[model samples]
Target: MLTIKGKLGIEDFYRIIFKEEAILINKDVLTTVENSFNFLSQFSQNKIIYGVNTGFGPMAQYKINDSDRIQLQYNLIRSHASGTGNLIPEQYVKAAMLARLNTLSLGHSGVHISVIELMTSLINKNITPVIFEHGGVGASGDLVQLAHIALVLIGEGEVFYKGERRPTEEVFKLENLKPITITLREGLALINGTSVMTGIGLINTINTRKLLDWMICCSSAINEIVQAYDDHLSLELNQSKKHKGQQQIAKSMRHHLKDSTLTRKREHHLYNGNNEVTIFEEKVQEYYSLRCVPQILGPVLDTLNNVEKILIEEVNSANDNPIVDVEKEHVYHGGNFHGDYVSLEMDKLKLIVTKMSMLAERQLNYLLNPNLNNILPPFVNLGTLGLNFGMQGVQFTATSTTAENQMLSNPMYVHSIPNNNDNQDIVSMGTNAANITKKVIENTFEVLAIETITIVQAIEYLKVQDKISSKTKKMYDDIRNLVPPISDKDVPMYPYVNKVKNFILNFEEEIYACKELN
Candidate 1:
């Protein structure tokens, strides 16, 4: 079961979202909810609350008559379900639902218990709402996109039932479920927050963190192949710089390369005494990718770690305006609903992904360039240069993908256009940042895929005299199965590229299982 203490951190949400079982718990939410309810009863006796007793945004000043207040919540949800674009993937929709639930659990929104129970039911039964990926400004709190989620709760929108899209009413009827009736501040609470942006950002953070680990692993693989100097990764050297990420990276690389026989042997002479000892002739220092691995990627890790901290806090927060502070006996209007915090973090993460993509692109270039590649054949071709076109096209693909990532990394937070008639003058656009960050991370995956394939081919060409490291050998065989060795007549390489990406996307466990066998 996924657990939420009042302090919801990014790492926690990430684990819960990725786990297929889909159970979640917010232990402190009930208390927060009670606090909100008490405040509403004591302080909201006569005044019109923006969402609870009056209209939403552009029309907030309009008064909601007592007779129409409850119906207003339902109308608000049904009307706001105007999303029209590509459906958000089931995984992301599920994540949004979870984020919404955690937000409600904070108890400042005055949502009914039945509403929370309904959301929990959808998660437990795997009843996913159909939501689109567009139309959120991240200022009015992902309003339109989240409305789709709210519609499912009230049996008015479409839902994925038994792997097929069906009307929420039918799905609820079939499951003997009833639509949750909105009461008091329920409707406003449901849609007025940053769940959509948070969901995308959380998911991106999860994948990006793992990708960073793999980049380090790949760097270690390169070190083993080149027999590069270990002095660059020394803890003392990284510690003096005081970068936690660099230190952590150095530790991971050292651990991964610790037992490899392919690395430089300090003894200088062969164990059998067959070869004479000689001073090294190659440059003492390696290329940037090899020597600067920790330096370049460490800051990225630190940034991601900080983003995770912010996400967890945001996910657990009560972000709706006019929060009910029961202890204070007041419904306080505030800007807790703003997504500025998430927008900032998401931008930072995008920059981190850009750096990682650039680094991966550089490493792939090194493997393909004959001079810089340390005696590897041009493009690591299996035969004579022209006889096989080799990894030339694949390298081009990497370069293009990295360039695209750099383009997408332009911060979305910096390009704010006022909306809602300038009432929302300074917006977050965090949803845009989250969506673009996801694409950037996806692009990074493709670049890494290209790098992985290139390294596999290079290793195949090497046929190393000493046994290749067991970990690397397993990775080599795995890629070979997905994309068999390229021959002169292999013609186009897209199929091979697609297959490699599929392996990364769908068979992650199998990939890790192979790693374990090593």
Candidate 2:
């Protein structure tokens, strides 16, 4: 369990999404916020502020008085509720809420304690507000989509409560809650930031990192079963290249396949004690998928590290305009809300998903080809070739998924057009990028699951009873428990696919933990 007052940071976000309970420390956050509000009072004469005392974006030039400021912010939310796309998932919306709370804890947005209290109520009560996946230009903040969140906060929009879509006002009333009154900057504070995009990208990055590690392990298992030449993954070769990703991947593959009896030794040991010995040599110096994996995957890891750093800064810093610095007794209007940083990160994440899908597609091709597979029918079957369709449809799925990923990888960062009539001309499109990346990640998982099925079926067909590494054998058996051998056509595979996903997601953790115990 974790709690956030003013001390919330990146590690807390990670654990919370990983299913840890999170609590709020409002008292501590209020202390800093009180000082910020006092500073605003002292500098009251210099109160010409954007997003605080005036209309936003193109209308920033219009001066709004104290009496009308609250209405202005309220109207801003209602008008910007123009999000017209698929509604974001509940978990993602919850994550965005958490991120917004984190940014507010910095106490620079001039939001009152009541707003924080309402946010805490929603968190503790499991009131997930509805937010859509489009209409954020990532400039002037994630305004349109987050407006829906703001509307719900004021008990005016829609929400998914207890797994049912209900009016926000009804849910609040049922929970004995009051709609928060819009304050001077509270509404703007609620919606004016990069939280929506950054939160999605951060979660995507974390999950993708785990998947990358699992891919290395799974690929090594395949290498051992196929008797790939260890020369390609040799430490000497990786050291000569000196890329961290390459070295790490090579080291990991070697470690995973270290004790396999199926692998070939040095050149001199090729001959047996008896007569002529059979030798297995791969046709290519390396399959494009296998050889370039490190190069393609390394940049993705490096880019993710950069994105994590940026997200840490975004989450911990104030992003709203007209920030008050009570310690310095000053207020400054700035463009902290621009989301170019998060946009590029999301673009990179989509690229990583694209690579994963491509790798899986290639592996699927390898397992299906008679020449490449060496053993088994045209596509790893039990009986004669034409009689059984085998894993034919699974290969079709892999190809289609890879194609989808490629299309989604078109960088959203570079597609900025003027929004709000040149005021937000150079938008980051960060929110769209994050949403697309999430879709790509889902598609990549489907591709990887199919590849796992294909490879396990191919290995079973070869019937190599010789002992593989302990880890590899365990994985094979795990897959076998869910998926029976491919003996005939027209077999129902949906259940097997679901079972494979369940196994693969948890497989690495179980294997590594068991090895550590030993």
Candidate 3:
């Protein structure tokens, strides 16, 4: 079980979302929440505060009586529950809920303690709101997406309960749960934040970190199969550049290639003969794809590091507008809910991931083409030459997928369109950026899968499996365990590709079980 006390970290959020851990609110946070509620109750009913006694957005000037405030909150939730895309994955919904709950726990949203308890109970009971994927401009706090969640709190929307989709009221009755009434600014507080975008970004950051490690492992295997020179990965040479990511990658490459007979030093094949007149024959160096692994992937590592920090701070921040200060007795209205920070970071992340996919595709090309592969059979076809196309179609799929990733890599931060009656004249498409980034990550995984299977096939064709490094040997064996190597007979590639992708997804566990293999 995890305890949310208004100060949740990224890792804790990960566990709560992915591991389905039950949550408990800190008693101190509950006291602070009650204090804010009491402070708000002291205000006269005619006070014209945004989303409390007055209307929202451009209609903020319209005042409401005490009798209609409750109805106004309900109407705000129902009217804004207009999300239209496919249902968001349950994990993301759960993450959004946790983020929203964490922000409210800060005790500045002027919400009653029962509101927080109800949200926490939804998480503990595995009752996830069916949030949609569209309708968020990422400004004014993911309004549409979050309103879908807010609707469920009042038993007005659908929810997923025990793996079945049902009305929130039916689920509440089945689980002995009761919906709470929204009071004062509670409805606005629930939807007015960056939780949707922040939750998606946070989850992707964690997964991308694992994917980076796996990409390095794949690059190491490709280097050994292509007989890359190890001088470029020398610690001394990398230290001259003075980049932490480059130096770290160089070190990791050395460790990955340690005890491998296939990786050659530059001098081993430098000269054709000892005679002074002899020509310097033999391919002295590898292609940039294999030689510049650290240089190309180094910046991606740094970007991931930077993005993770921003997401951590965003998740832990009080991103709601009109923050209530109990100690100062003030209601300060501000734009803390803008998602530009996450939008820009996610856009950068997608571009970096697209470059990684491009690199993987180049390596895959090198492994399949006969001329580039240096004596490897065309398409690494082990079967009858003309009859079997061997990884030919597979490479094409990878190429096309990488192209799609490139198309999706355009920065979303710069493409904001005005909406919401121009009240939100400038918007942050943070959620759109994050959603497409998830697709890019998935596509990159498929590209890496193609590369992994192709590398294993090359090692098998060369009959040099025994010469691979111990780390590559483990990884190669793991791949083979999932799907057999390409043989003389041609077969459908989708099933095999999917199996390898799943293997890549679960590769982290294999590395954990064997510390030296990653």
Candidate 4:
């Protein structure tokens, strides 16, 4: 079990989200939370505190009475729990809950300690709040999606407990859990932040790391299949470009093709030959997709590194309104609830991942076209050319899915629509950005899986698997284990394609041996 203290780091997220480790809150954090609540209890006694003594958003013109103060929080939570569309998957919800818990642990949100305790229990029990994919403008920071979380905190709404959607009350009762009482500002504090988007973005970034490694492997494998010159990935060539991502990508490619017998050295193949033929058969340079893996995926790596940094800062921040300061003994109101940070990062991430998918599609095309790769049969079909279909049908799936990723890469950050009586004008559509990014990411995985299968088929037709690098051979063996080389005949391909997708999704290994994420 992992213990969350004052701050949360990226490693903490890896432990809880990926390693399936349960978490505990430090006692000092609970003390800090109680102190903040006490300070707010006295500080807001006569002053007008937003979302506490006054109505929320455009309704702040009206003041709430003392008798209705506690009920006000419940009203906000229940009313805003109006999110619609498909339910977000359980893993993302858990990450969001972790994000919210980490922020509240900072003690600036003025939430009661019961709030922290209840969230800890929910997370440890693997009981996730049922959140939807829509109804958030991200101006007030995932208002609708987080309200579902607030609703569950008060023992209302629904939760996915033990692999099923059940009433929050039923799960709480089964687990002997007690709901948090509305003390001061738990409702507004819980819902008013970028936790939802941060959570989803965190999960996306983690999976993106996996996708990138696999894409790099596929890129290196394709170069080996075509017997491309190794100078394109030479240390002298890529390092001179002055990009860390480029140098690192070239480094990884060198490792992958280290034992490859197919990739030829330009000095050995071209320089040694003194033939005076005007038009030699071998092409000088490969297509950009195979040769420029470093130049293309370099920006992808740099962007991913930046995205991870910004998200870590976001999760550890005090992102709620009316931040209560026990040390200053004051309540300060501001717009820390805005989600522009998460929104912008998600958009950038979506755009880069789409670019990766496009690269994969182009590489897959080069493998299928007989003219581009004179090494393999057309479509790598070992059967009668026209009578039996080979990988031709499956290539369509890769092409269409890549087109969808391109379409989905349009930025959601610049497409905000004002709501909340224009009080939330100039909003951030962060949740939508994150959701759409998730779709693009999953689609890219499918596209890469198709590309991976095609690369293996080319290797099989060449019958030079014995000469391939150890890395490429492992990939070939893993894929061939799922389904044999699609030669002599083609079986039903949809299930086979999905099987590869699932393999990509579930497969975990350390491919970034030369470089580790910072």
Candidate 1 per-residue lDDT, tens place, 1-518, comes to 66554555654665666666555556456666666665675566688778877888878889889889889999988888887778888888888888888888777787777877788889878899998877787887888888999988878889998899999999998999988867686778888999988888888887887678678767878877877767788887898998887888888777777767777743363334644547645755789988998898888888988898788788888887877766656677878878888998999998999899899889888888888866688887886678787888888888999999988988888878898888889888888888889888888888888888888877777776246666666667788888766655546888888787666654445232113110
Screening candidate 3 with a backbone cut-off below 3 angstroms (N, C-alpha, C), the clashing residue pairs are none
**Reference-based lDDT, each prediction:** 0.79, 0.76, 0.85, 0.89
Pairs clashing within candidate 2: none
Give the distance in Å from residue 174's predicted Cα in candidate 4 to where it truly belongs. 0.9
Query: What residue runs in model 4 are displaced by over 4 Å at the alpha carbon?
Result: 273-275, 512-518
Candidate 2 off by > 4 Å: 5-10, 268-284, 502-518
* Ten-residue region with minimum lDDT total, candidate 3: 509-518
lDDT of 4 by residue, 1-518 (tens): 88899787777898898788988888898899888888888888888999888899999999999999899999999999999999999999999999999999999998989999999988888999999998988888889999999999999999998889999999888999989979788889999999999999998898887788889899999998888999999999997999998888888889888988989989987898668879878799999998899999899999999999999999999998978888878888889989999999999999989999999999999988989888777887878888777789988998999999989999999997888988988988999999999999999999988898888888888888899999999989989998777777669988878898899887766663234533
Instruction: Give per-residue CA lDDT, model 3, range 1-518, as digits (tens).
Output: 77777887766976787667888888898998899888877753446577788889898878888789899988888999999978888888888888888888887888877789899999999899999989898988889999999999988799998899989999998888878667788789888999999888888887777677777888888888778778999987899997787777777778888888998887665544556745544466788988898898888888888998898888888888888888988788888888899999999999989999999999899888888867689998888889888899899899999999999999999988998799999999998988889889989989988988888888889887899899888888888997787778788999989998887765536441123311
Question: Candidate 3 at 229: error in angstroms?
Answer: 1.1
lDDT of candidate 1 at residue 514, scale 0 to 100: 18
Better of 2 and 3 by TM-score: 3
**Per-model TM-score on C-alpha atoms:** 0.91, 0.92, 0.95, 0.98
Number of clashes in every candidate structure?
Answer: 7, 0, 0, 0
lDDT of 3: 0.85
| Ranking of all predicted structures according to TM-score, beginning with the best and ending with the worst | 4, 3, 2, 1
Give the range of the ten consecutive residues with the poorest summed lDDT in model 1: 509-518
